[model samples]
Target: MHDAATPSRSQPITAGVLTALVGFTSSFAVVLAGLTAVGASPAQAASGLLVLCVAQALGMLWMSRRHRIPLSLAWSTPGAALLAGTGVPDGGWPAAVGAFVVVGLLILLTALWPHLGDLIAMIPAPIAQAMLAGVLLSLCLAPVRAVVDDPWVIAPVILTWLALVRFAPRLAVPAAFVVALVVIVIWTAGHGGPTGDWLPRIEGTVPAFEVGALIGIALPLYVVTMASQNVPGVAVMASYGYQVPWRETMTVTGLGTVAGAFAGGHAVNLAAITAAISAGPDAGPDPKRRWIAAETAAWSYLVLAVASVALTTLAVSGPPGVVETVAGLALLGTLGASLSAAVSATEGREAAVVTFVVAASGVSVAGIGAAFWALVAGLVTAAVLRRR
Candidate 1:
């Protein structure tokens, strides 16, 4: 009964489904790898994933409901990468839990203080856009990289994506995801793809605070989550002309992070890459209707939270880059838009370029990632060249 003038269900359906698929496929492995590296057994890692997914779903629901924007929330992927490299704290996973609690408290502090959110919001628009481009640079390369490594599996997927984009833009990412999923299932049928349990195995640990974990894990995790994830997340929304209320975004995620830690989840923050996906025109031709896409994403996140065990099993068992390739392809449009925004204003062009390069470099100092430095570099460049 739907005509061309009437909205296609595909818009919301694809937006929601892609949001969930991208959330799971892209960085779930990085999170799992991080948890395991921190001395979490299999059960503990799965538990962490489940709790984080649920936490993110809750944050998304709250934010989207209050603000009416497609504001997506996610666990800190860079923070997880940090944990993977940061040696296990002295008291093991329990110590890590305690560190998570500390991070939650710090996040809460900013949420309660309007000025803190304002401080983050005050970051120049071009630099913010550049930082976003930098953060997403590596993940956006997966589609091409996959062609080099596994062209047969990836070629059909990308082809389908390209065709859909040309003729059926709304369904592009979702269709690509379906294609990728089928190929993974068929190829991994007996190939020993990452195989294991996919059941919600809740592993509870009493938090044990350690000074070492606080300084090494908690502080750095807090910084990275704030700078790399939350800050850029705000930027992505701004790029699309949506003004997200930073206070609500921070308060909900901060509290959610605190609650999720008992269940072994880590820092929860605003999503940077996926936000662009949901907030963009692909979610819907009409910007007003895009919030529906975020609402759909919230529902999908909750569903995935319940199915975290199964999703984890599939993620670990997939062909090495299958998930990442899909993630990159899905995000290509957003990346292009971000690049355009970064370079659009000649006034801040030089600063934005420095920000993009440094942020893309993935350089870290004292365990802090480059997103913050990218902002700093861009700001300094702007300041130094102000007279020119």
Candidate 2:
């Protein structure tokens, strides 16, 4: 078993900053996309996302210290989208919150029954990777579309980001986003755009209990959060050699989701792509020290959640083209790697293909989202074709 002393040299400040920034920025986009799709006013959606970011960051810190592992939590992107598409219509934010609490409890229960974790482990790595790639493909495309619609706004940002990533890898991700934001602000100001309502404004709603709401919103939310977000997130951590207890991690994620829901945040879970940053060598070569960084991220998230409404609004109301482009560019590397790994795994190509296609197709049934369906399809296909 690893101990904190093992990573004594890894400084908390740098690791925490990087982890928080990556988590906040990457997940924030998906939150906005979900909100926009659901017809949430820009301000309301932004506030909700900020609450999520804060909760995830805090959860990451608490769990990392408690488990002595670099565990990071995040809002489930696919789950958020699923909620946007189906959840709001069923019972709105209240039902979504109820679902989050239930899921958290379920995750905690899984700790007592290791079989659930074992069941998740049975999923083939390649297929899991393929599902991740499919989920991220749309995110990668956002920047390109943004550029086409507003080349003057997005082109320079992308170009500058690419150049920096190639030459100054450390600054590439954050710098690109910051630069784009600055440019956007200047452009908006020049055009006499609205600035008074730039930041997110808080508007809290109390959750109400309803069985139908639970069925329509909660169950599906739990299913997608586990299948699409948590499953792949665990895989990413494993790939980086972090042998954390799956049950505990899930439990914490569930708890974070519960906390976030009270504050209007949607589903929170383990992060897949962004988790790679801290899990890998970038966080630190020493495994133990990385926990410190993770702790810091969690603390930062808590603080952010406390101030969610404002930060989220700023992110949302800001220049859309710039933010979307920066987000896509930041994820470019992770997306490429995930896709390659998915297709390359032995005995997994067909399964991976099935997962990718289904997830990308954006189809849902009985309120269940595409991620769950993708895994089902891939597994079924793999089983059927095995005898051939």
Candidate 3:
């Protein structure tokens, strides 16, 4: 006889599938844009996307089954936004790859070194969120520009996203992506159909370290991924009565990021928003059974990996600003949340505002990007204000 606690099989599975759909469809364009901004070609960017999926899938599956916790993993969407804002470093793509590797190593260090983790935690929350908001500011403007530049192509996607957000908030971004995909299809058909090599493959890069890339890209990426994704992910799961295996979780994600970096991927970390779907009551009445939702999402990510090449082709070949509109729309929620958190507290509001302005300026000094400078500026301001 089935255990009395066991509920219907489909509930967890459906939640798992929805988790994957929302996670992938919502922010992939941002990933592609980030990789490209940091010097990846279309092929390399596609490879990065493929490897990120495979790596996170493998990590999530192992961790969820090992701990029997609903542990979902994801590529760092905030880190991607940081990249989109950072532009290319001194040594270009290889330098960017090297920066990615450094981020992974830093994550590993965080797991092994308690002090390192504590140091990250010591960073003022307002400053960190302000930095992320600054990084995302420019990308969030894409939809507005698209509406002005190509209203006909962008109007339907914006309308779809708005409609779904009202009734089905979780599906809003994915629905926008669907509309964008349909627009791409129609645009492609008119432009003589899709054209490109559609077979998914990993394009390897030999990482080359440079001081500018490390300080500019690696430091900010690590901070954003930790502050925005990993830390919040743990808290989200904890609210559901699950204590994530911190060491094991970090070890797995760190290793996964390291492995994916060689294949042109950026970073992978714990899921924030999507974790609630897999860990929440909707997955099942019994908390023990919720891990299945994570497992299911992992498998779903693998399936999506196969379509990396096709999706990359469509995004690249689509009408100008159309895919960007989708990417921008996808980040709006994140930007709003970050901005709210940044300015919500009066204690550090001045420091946080300074961070946001410096980051949004997109300034580079001594070859380092605004993200790093923004953090430095915020911390200094906070320290000065506290002293006064």
- Number of the top-ranking candidate, with lDDT as the measure: 3
Q: Write the per-residue lDDT of candidate 1 for residues 50-89, one digit (tens) a residue.
A: 9998888877777787778888888887677656555466
TM-score of each: 0.68, 0.76, 0.97
1 against 3, candidate with superior TM-score: 3
- Please provide, for model 3 over 99-159, each residue's C-alpha lDDT reduced to its tens digit, 9 standing for 90 to 100: 9999999999988986888898999999999999999999999999989998999999999
lDDT (Cα) of model 3 = 0.93
lDDT of 1: 0.77
In candidate 2, stretches whose alpha carbon ends up further than 4 angstroms from where it belongs are 1-10, 64-72, 77-102, 195-247, 270-291, 302-308, 318-320, 346-348, 364-368
Task: Give model 3's TM-score versus the native structure.
Answer: 0.97
Ranking by TM-score: 3, 2, 1
Question: Candidate 3: how many backbone clashes?
Answer: 0
Residues 18-74, candidate 2, lDDT per residue (tens digit)? Answer: 777766654455566665554355665766676677667767767787778778777
For model 2, what is the C-alpha lDDT against the true structure?
A: 0.67
Clashes counted in candidate 2 amount to 7
- Which wins on lDDT, candidate 2 or candidate 3? 3
